[model samples]
Target chain A: MGDFDFSIIAANWRFLAEGLRYTVQVTLTAMVGGILLGTLLALMRLASLWPLRWLAAAYINFFRSVPLVQVILAVYLILPLLLQFLTGRLIPIGADNSAYFTFTIFEAAYYAEIIRSGIQSIPRGQVAAGYALGFTYSQTMRLVVLPQAFRNMLPVLLTQTIVLFQDVSLVYAIGATDFFGAADKITQRDLRPVEMYTTVAVVYFVLCFALSRLVKYLQSRIAIIR
Target chain B: MNYHWDWLFFFQEADDGLMYYQWVLSGLGWTVAVSLTSLAIALLLGSAFGVLRTTPNRWLIAIGDTYVDVFRNIPLIVQLFLWFFVLPELVPRDIGLWMKQDLPYFVTAVIGLGLFTGARIAEQVKAGINSLSRGQRFAGLALGFTEWQTYRYVRLPMAYRIVLPALTSEAMNVYKNSAVTYSVGILELYFQYKQIIEKTSQVLEITIVITLAYFVVAFATNRLFAWIEQRSRVPGMIAGGQGGK
Candidate 1:
């Protein structure tokens, strides 16, 4: 107990902060990109066309079924190779960038499900009213449905984003310098596993716990009137 | 495509005289062991804590809530890392060295995985119990059954039945999260992924094979849980007594 020295964390705060910045950056990128692609996937899955529905279902199922760590590694290794095979050139998407792509696509599967549920939660009459107004299908979704769905599902979406934030740590498998990975590196270099990992755990707990509390509050406040 | 595809690489010998497929199988065994053992821990702990949260006692509820918050909010990998590396340092010198040098990595991974998943299962259990109508609790109390007995008989069984579907998903997640144990260098399937890839330099094939392996396990878990859910279902209960799907 006496050996507890947080000076290690204090000395390396900047390095740790850089890692924290990368983690947040990836979370935001994946959040925006995943939600975009996820909305597309959700629409496809909800479409009348069987082929589009099937394709979206397959993508969601395949990604959701695998571990995030494996996909991080797979994308880190396989994505570039597949690209080179098709394009005849090796595009250098580094491990860090690879984490971005993997999380975006992988998380899109989950976000798609959330979005699909959100869309489902909106009554059929709302869509019908849009159609009754002589609005086109795309127009109804873009103008009437999506905005409402986004608001109604905001709490759930934020909860998932909190999950995504924690998941950013899985990039450690592919050697990305995320917050957890930064702590890991410092631990290795300084041989102070106690201080480094403890600090990381405390930071993660405070952030996630506070965020989840916010989600709980929002769920009560912004819940749609049924 | 400049890649060489060797479908027969699994049959090749490694340095330890085991075929490459044997190594993969060994890793798979560890993965299964880690997940199944952790599931046992999770179910027991989750049920206990789950009941704790729903109990009338404020003290018990506090303990359960604290457990859920601490374990669930922290990423599993961090928990695993702490349990694996920093735990020993925090303990007394002799025992710490023993833990560092003597404790099996498999046990460490399972403890971390179990506690983390247990917190999640507790939440599910709490929800399941909460979803039940208030009349049932009142009826149990009117029957002169003590609070513990009432829970032991009436609430828990129905709660388990009600939340079997959610439990199934958590069970499947145990398999997925087991991959994180690889970071601690346990000889699990993910660890072997690095091994086979490094040894044979066959990235694409091995990656596909491992991914398929994970998918199969997860899919099977889903099906098994579906079967269980249907079998133990009570008529006119949640989901209108329909299939869990």
Candidate 2:
């Protein structure tokens, strides 16, 4: 029943900016950490050692099966206790840190699957060519396979990143003051839930839509012609 | 800091005369109900829009693209809040009043979750349809069938079978995404987990149990869909590879 007010948002621009900063910070951190760990996991799953493959598969399956909210809650609550038990001292793994770690760990499973497919898409003859030219397993993966895989899967990776950006909002469950959370706090304070939520929704839609279009463009550009 | 673990705490009855496990069961019921209902909506709407996107008509494709872009980009929690709070105010006054007064939280959650997920499904359905060879469509048309009948009998069945793996993942995603409905105050499993944690302060045990419950649901859904994918798969049709978690 209340009229929309842009002035409320204008007055609180600083708070919203801080929230956006934190959201971007967590997203970038998670993206880097997730890709590193996920690539390792994908390599492990494709490893010659059965135990290594089993361990990697189990980790991916367990994480993939559970909801991200559960992972966020568990990490937020349990990581501190785990640290305390292990070291007999309580470390302050704050909500934002917990959110970052959880996103990294949870998203790795998804990225692992994507990266695995990318790696597989490379012809076996290429790997054999690497070995045939006197390369170790690690050297072959690094020098040839991984670079090509990254190129092949760039679109999927960026698509997942867009999904990750949307998921960053879920950090609100733990009160991390991401963009959505910042808007939510304003709503609570201003008693203008409709305007605040509508603004936040529009912001999210624009960001995600733009990112998806970029992904599409990348997909078309880097599309490896068979 | 010296908290003792109470593995049996879930078995203990609360003052309300129900055990915590019972609360979880009821929460699971709501979760399943919400997920399945939303999935039904997603399939119907998603397929419609997906098929529309594949048509040669420009306007229909624009409508499909707009639907997917609008629904898929916004986060589900935001959508849920919008449905629960802003939507009623935006509609006609009488209907708005009825929505605010008579519409249940479950209905709101379903609409929010369904439409949001329906967008994702629309993308998958479109991809599945596009993956089919043009020969399949021509073959259907050449068989003296109308376009609608050709789609229903020939193209759709094959498309659904091809996309079964992606559909499986979407089914599991719907169940997981249902957790977001807790934002709108639906007493689903995640909501119940928060409630129990607040009252009991047994965060670790409760969270572990909730995680396992979600895992079981997702795992079962995965297995069920994998089975369907196996049965319905065409012998050598691109292997029906799984994608999109």
Candidate 3:
């Protein structure tokens, strides 16, 4: 305890900030990619086609049921072998692939469930109204249904973003220097576990608090629209 | 690169053939036991907080809000680390020293998972209670039930049924989240699997086994939750009262 110095934090702030940039970038990229993939899965599940429905259901069930850490680990371990064989090249993606793929696929599975539930929560009459107006099924979904469904989903999506943001820390396990990873290195180097961990916790708390407040604000705005 | 069928030999003893399957079984037992114990704690604490959040007292509401906020915002891994590592140090000197030395890793993991998931359950329960009709509470009071009795026998039972879906999801999530405790070195399935993989270099086989184990646990949980939901469902609430669709 006596050996610990607050001065070290003052000096290493830049290093921590650099780590924070990587962490935020990884989270944002994953959130965008995951939401896109998740939306596709949600649409596939909603589709009337049998094989697509089965495939979507299986994907959601398997991914949602398994632990995210396990998913991250499995992809980190196995993706390189599969991708390289398929591409016939030692693609640079796998070399630092841990950072990119882990966040994207893990967040995608969760977002798929979120979007599916959001779609289901929309009243059935809205779709009936679309059909009554002579719109085709796909046209109704695009024109009438999804807009309202997405509004209902806004709050849940924000909540899920916070969850994904928090999970970005796990990138460290597979060897990406995320915020937690940066703190881990410092802790190991300095042997000041308490101070280092507390700093990490404080950073996480601030970011998450801001996020929830934004969600609350959006909820009110959406309510006004309703 | 022909795979050997004799690979199964590594799992058995060379001569007398005593399979140490008992270790895997015991590990699974601990996993289930931990999950159940945590679920119990989560349900009990979540109920208490859920009720407190609705209490008339402003201070209790504030306390409940803060509890939910802190636990909900932080990542589970960070919370686990805090509970397992920093918490002991924060305790009063003698007890802190004792806890630091005396508490087993498994027990700590259970406590951490329970407290964290309990926070989530509290919000779900509170939301369920708020969604109930005010007339029911009025009726309970008119029937000469006290406040506590009104809550326990009247509001809570109905709220529990209403929140069955959310609560079931939370319980399943709690089971999955329990796996994170492996970070703290609890020999739950994942941690042990890691050790096995490192030793044998049979990553694919072992990972397949682990994934299947997780799926079975999840499937069984979903079935159980479905059964409970069916039993607790309101008499008239199925399919929004329009059956035979």
Top lDDT model: 1
As for DockQ, the candidate ahead, 2 or 3, is: 2
Candidate 3: Cα lDDT at B192: 58
TM-score ranking from best to worst?
Answer: 1, 2, 3
Alpha-carbon runs more than 4 Å astray in model 2? A224-226, B230-245
lDDT of 1 by residue, B67-140 (tens): 99999888989999899888999888899999888888888889999999999999999998999898888889
Candidate 3: deviation at residue A150, Å?
A: 2.2
Candidate 1's DockQ is 0.84
> Could you tell me the TM-score of chain A in candidate 1?
0.97
Higher-scoring candidate on TM-score, 2 or 3: 2
Alpha-carbon DockQ of candidate 2: 0.61
- Which candidate number has the best DockQ? 1
Off by over 4 Å in 3: A1-5, A88-96, A121-144, B1-23, B237-245
Clashes of each: 0, 0, 0
Q: Could you tell me the lDDT of residue B20 within candidate 2?
A: 91
DockQ order of candidates, top first: 1, 2, 3
lDDT by residue for model 1 over A149-214, one digit each (tens)? Answer: 998999999999999999999998888899999999998898999899999999999999999999
lDDT of 3 at A22: 83
The residue pairs that clash in candidate 2, if any, are none
Q: How many backbone clashes does candidate 2 have?
A: 0
lDDT tens digits, residues A142-166, model 2?
9999999999999999889988888
CAPRI grade of model 3: acceptable
